[model samples]
Target: MLSATPRTSLGREKHRGSTDRNDLYQVLDTGLVCHLGVVADGHPMVVPTCYGRVGDTLYLHGSTGARSLRAADGAEVCVTVTHLDGLVLARSIFSHSVNYRSAVVYGRARLVTDPDERMDGLRALSEQLVPGQWDYARRPSRKELAATAVLALSLEEASVKIRQGAPEDEDEDYALPVWAGVLPLVTAWGKPEPDPVLPEGIETPVHILRRE
Candidate 1:
């Protein structure tokens, strides 16, 4: 179950809210990018970032010099991931909406300083981006590790919302002679584009070529 705290609870659209913890995890797992919100120098900042989840923890990494990650250390932050599924066209403008799945997590990000934990966090982030990339590519070196910073946040407080299917038009509006249907959106991977400088004989690995 999700927390009922004021910050995490769904106040306005309670009908779309979900209490199943698995729903939160599912959204996080399927999402490719997340927006990290933090307060920096008394000003709010939101940065687009990649993240990884390990059990109950979410890991975010960036260059040590990134201001957003620096300010996130030991500070409360909000992380959100959303997937646009389709556009709902209704007979009335008021009933028009979008189908989507979204998750929001709130917690104080703990700066990961320990070398072992830091490496683990980085591994998670790498694997999240490319399932087999961690094992396929060279691991981070000590010098490279020093230039990176990782933040760990618990997935204890979160909210999940999902909206799907056709629009809910009013009874009177349904009788109108208006075309109404869903415009479904689908995401797919295109053929791989090889790097210009890559060696001619080198072929793309099956793991990457077949990645979904």
Candidate 2:
């Protein structure tokens, strides 16, 4: 359940619209890393980490060294995921901006206490990086899960902002003899690197080898 909010400047031009819970989860599922923000000692603490979304929940795994997580328990926190599609190059630097998609979730994060949900959340997190990874990789052991801290946040309160296409330069600037076009950006996976101690007969899985 997402409430109606004022549209962002860029959101009005394209994808900036009311982002319901479903759109946010889809964005979370599409990306691997997210930045979690919280207040620590009255100062903002933002940490970049891996996250995943399942149903109406967003889960982030962090280390004991993380201050944001410690201070964020039962307190309101903001988790965001952003994907930059390209650089909007304008005739003038003043009108230059970026083409990107971003989602921000606001809610109180709680430590996942249920054992079954914790493992299931971790599987969702693993599957985020690679769709079939949860089944392919070894599941977390009891001791390992105990050592990890997973924070869960509801997806009900969130926002999405996006911008697309060319820059908004002055009409007169069109005549200026300068390059005015988008500098494209894209994310891609590299060739698989096998472990030095990997078993001899274990070739890279087709999912990893054929990843785009």
Candidate 3:
């Protein structure tokens, strides 16, 4: 686990530095998509898409038409992975914000060029989408790997910000007649639908069917 080099604000509190990065990896592994931000032609853009973490690197996959993929090539990009655990309904609307665990990873992304590593990256990307899918489905041919674009960003410059529990209201506001508690949020997967072209024998593997 590499610590951040202090390129950005760590956190508001003194002990808020989450530079261990393993925690960030854990959060990223739990979530399938991330809001990837990068500067292109002097403008900032944030694109939402799926991602996967293999050790310290975060891999983002996209199609050829995606604008974010074009901007990420050889550019310093920021990817944010967030999970909303609850909604903090405070006494005042101004004090309201979702309780979330989020990580911002900063690094110049390089388009994966190695043939061997490209397939591995694609596997990680696929597993993130549907666990056990990589092994269950046919592997990509060399030509398929060459067509897909994958970017790997390191965990060197990243930070995590979390807000949990109940809302923080002012002393006077707490006495006011208003609701102030947490409405817990959750994310879950539905039944896996098989492809229409599939042969009848295939079934959902345990990894996908049993994931918590």
Candidate 4:
């Protein structure tokens, strides 16, 4: 279960809140990018970046020179992932809303230093973005590894909120002639485009072609 921390508590729309830990994992695992919030140079900064999750830990990586990554190391941070499912149309304009699944996590991010763990974290990140590319592509060299920075944040303190189905309209608005329903949104992978300069004999890998 997720910890009931003050930061993770919901002040409104409590009906949409979820305390189940699995819900948090589901939201994070399905998401391809996350917005990381942190205080940098006494100002709030939110950066959109790719991430990976292993067990209860979330790993984020970027260039070592990035200011956001530098500020996040050893500092409290907030990470969020959201998936928009549909647009809910109601009889009244005020009742119009969206269906989405979102998760917010709060924790102190620590910079990974151990060589083996750093490599593992990088692998997790690579796999999260592209399943088979990590093994197929050339591994990072020593100089490349030194130029990258990885931070790990625990998922113990998190909150999840999900909204689905049709929108709710007031009783008086039900009699109105306005149409009401849901427009679902779907995401899919596009066809792979091979590099133009590559040798003609090479072809797209099975893993890339098989992705749905």
Candidate 5:
């Protein structure tokens, strides 16, 4: 079950809140990018970045010189991953809404320093972005690793909210002639385009080509 911390608790739309921890994992895993919320220089900053999950830990990586990463390390932060499933069109504009799966995690993100764990975190990050590319592409060198910063945030305190199905409108509004239904938003991978400078014989990798 997810923690019921005050920050994680949903004061409104309680029915949309999910206590199942798996739902939290599902929301994070399906999403490609996460919005990292942190307080930098006494100002709130929300940055969209790529992330990876390993067990209950979420890994965020960027250049060591990035101010967001610098401020997030050793400080409390909020990370959110959301997937918009559909648009809910109702008979009345007041009832308009969206179907989405979202998860918000709250914890103190720590900068990873252990060499082995750092590599593992980086590997997880790379694998999350492209499954088989880590093995197929050239690995990072020592200097590259030194310039990168990885932060690990625990998923111990989090919240998951999911909304689906048709829109809900007022009793009288439902009887109107206006159409009310959900327009699902589907995301699909397009055909892979190779680099312009690549050798002619080097074809697109099987892992990328097989993505759906």
Candidate 6:
């Protein structure tokens, strides 16, 4: 069961909320990007960024000089990942909504200082973005590693909300001639475009060529 902290509890649309830890993992695992929210200069700021999850921890990295990462380090931050599945159409305008799976996590991020953990976190990030790339590419050098910063946040406190299937229309409106159904959305990887300066004999790796 997932923990229900004050911030993780859903205030509204409780029916759509999920308490299953697997559901939370599923949402996070499938998402490509997450929005990290932090308080900077007395104002809330949100940044779109790529992330990687390993077990119960989520890792985020950026340049050491980044203001958002610097300000959010060791502070309470909220990370959210959402996937749009479809557009729900109802007879009434107010009843219309989107079918989506979203997860919000609240925790205090700790800047990763250990060299081993930092390298492992970076590997996780690379593998998450592109499977098998971490092994395919060269490792980071000391100078490059010094310029990057990684933050680790626990996934213990999180909220998962999923809206799926068709829209719910009122009984009175069901008799109306208005058409209503869901318009599904799909996401997939496109054809790979090779680098122009690549060696003539070099071929696309299977990990990238088979991406879908």
- The lDDT per prediction is 0.93, 0.80, 0.81, 0.92, 0.93, 0.93
Quote the positional error of residue 67 for candidate 4 in Å: 0.8
**Which residue pairs come into collision in candidate 2?**
11-16
Q: Per-residue lDDT of 8-71 in model 6, one digit per residue for the tens?
A: 8899999999999999999998888999999999999999998998999999999999999988
lDDT: which is higher, 1 or 2? 1
How does residue 68 of candidate 1 score in lDDT? Answer: 95
As a whole number from 0 to 100, the lDDT of residue 64 in candidate 2 is: 51
Instruction: Give the poorly placed runs of model 4, Cα more than 4 Å off.
Output: none
Evaluated at residue 116, the lDDT of candidate 4 is: 89
Cand. 5 Cα-lDDT: 0.93
Every model's TM-score: 0.97, 0.89, 0.87, 0.97, 0.98, 0.98
Candidate 4's displacement at residue 84, Å, is 0.9
Error of 6 at 162 (Å): 0.4
Give stretches of model 6 more than 4 Å off.
none
* Candidates 3 and 6, the one with greater TM-score: 6
Global local distance difference test of model 3:
0.81
Q: How many residue pairs clash in all the candidates, one count each?
A: 0, 1, 0, 0, 0, 0
lDDT of 2 by residue, 48-149 (tens): 888877788988886655677788788989888999999999999899999887888888899999988888788888878787878887887777877888
Q: What TM-score should be assigned to candidate 1?
A: 0.97
